[model samples]
Target: MRAADRFSFNHATAKFWDQREAVEACARAGVGIGLWREPVQEMGLEASAKLVQDAGVAVTSLCRGGFFTDPTPAAIDDNRRAIDEAAALGAPALVLVSGGIPAGGTIDGAREGVQEALSVLAPYAGERGVTLAIEPLHPMFASDRCVVTTIGEALDLAAPFPAEQVGVVVDTYHIWWDPQVWQGIARAGREGRIASFQFADWVTPLPAGVLTGRGQLGDGCIDFKRYLAEVDAAGFTGPIEVELFNDALWARPGAEVLAETKAAFERVVS
Candidate 1:
């Protein structure tokens, strides 16, 4: 299939854009989308599901469903609801950002929380035909954002569950700096744990909020072609979701951003 054919826009890339408009745009572009829970909830789960279903656009994966470092009952219950939402939207995977250490808690303890949370949710997700996709953010976010900081680590966390129930998200922006990333991708693929693959460039001179500092494709240090080659070599053939979080891009008109992102994706990785 053509590279463009596999393109999937992540809604977070255009944060302020209307969810319905984003779905329509993806449909018009004949691409797929990765949705988030907030807008889905605002639109009402059933309404959001119907919107995508009517648009005939593939919902590649739901943005998130994990933050169980503390692993309270509330957290576990929320993740279960997230799984149900993914099933409702026909999203095959629910991307998980395992929360960071709680107050006075150690990183190892936080990881344990992730495992505990997964043990409870993986089977629930599988029953709903959704895979729990663990996403390892960059180590810079290890303290406040995600405890899982490497694909290898994410894979290790997913080890106890069946591949169909639990997997990892290979997001370039987060793992590009890791020397072992290529090996991790290969291992994830070999183990059948590649549930989602996303693209984002890493730029220096990060903005005030590092979380929103991801660069557009081809605009930063990440080598898109190499990432594409590596993941492909690892045997993954799924939607290539470009999930940028740049503040500047978010400020632009969503449709224009989508068009530019699509063009950039083709230019850099095709």
Candidate 2:
């Protein structure tokens, strides 16, 4: 199955892991990877690109490139650079975590900023063969994270572009709680907007900033098999990237964490 064949490790899962070691670990584990921007920048984009390419691992998506709600010229320029980096790294999609409400700004206004930013970047992304995967973060992050909180909202934002240019990322941690999740998945498939499918189990009493509180595959309320069924049924045959941001996972040995995560994913999804 394409979905099963495309399992990936989101670098955020083991953030403390060294960049080179993480890529090597992913290759050793026989999985693809969703690369983060900071580490890539730190390692120097060319060096990071060469390492991943030399490892022969697929770079599913670039961790992020949006947050242009303020839409300053500087922000747009940065996004453009991200698009180029994604292309250089052979990443098919660039995940966009649309910035949260700017100071004193309403959520509605922040969303408008996302729309505007998308309009600016979508074309450039299209030209570079990089899809912009708008990730609708969980509502818990509506205040300080992403403004797009539902698959439906992401689709609406993506409606203006061809599926190849603009699309949505289905992360279970963010959308599992939505009552309308199934419908959203169906819509994404029907509209040809499922650019990336990510996974992260949901846990309660979210951490302070709600950034590093993701649950492991079998440790939370999410039903991985069911999500797999839904996305598969919706015809989304892409990499199922596990993107847990748990502090505990980050504290462990990278190889151990990767092995555990892969096993948990297989156990839950089977």
**Alpha-carbon RMSD to native, per candidate:** 0.7, 1.3
Q: Write model 2 residue lDDT over 1-270, tens digit each, in one string.
A: 644566799888889889899999889888999998899999999999999999999999998998877889999999999999999999999999998889988988988999999888899999999999999988878888788999999999999989999999999999998999999999999988998998888777667746888888888889888889998888877788999888888889988988888888788776
Q: Residue 185 error for model 1, in Å?
A: 0.6
Q: Which residue pairs show collisions in model 1?
A: none
The most accurate candidate by lDDT is 1
Cα misplacement distance, residue 175 of candidate 2 (Å):
0.7
After superposing candidate 1, which stretches have Cα over 4 Å from the reference?
none
Q: Mind giving the per-residue lDDT tens digits that candidate 1 earns over 213-270?
A: 9999988999888888888888888999999998899889999999999999999876
Question: TM-scores of all models?
Answer: 0.99, 0.96
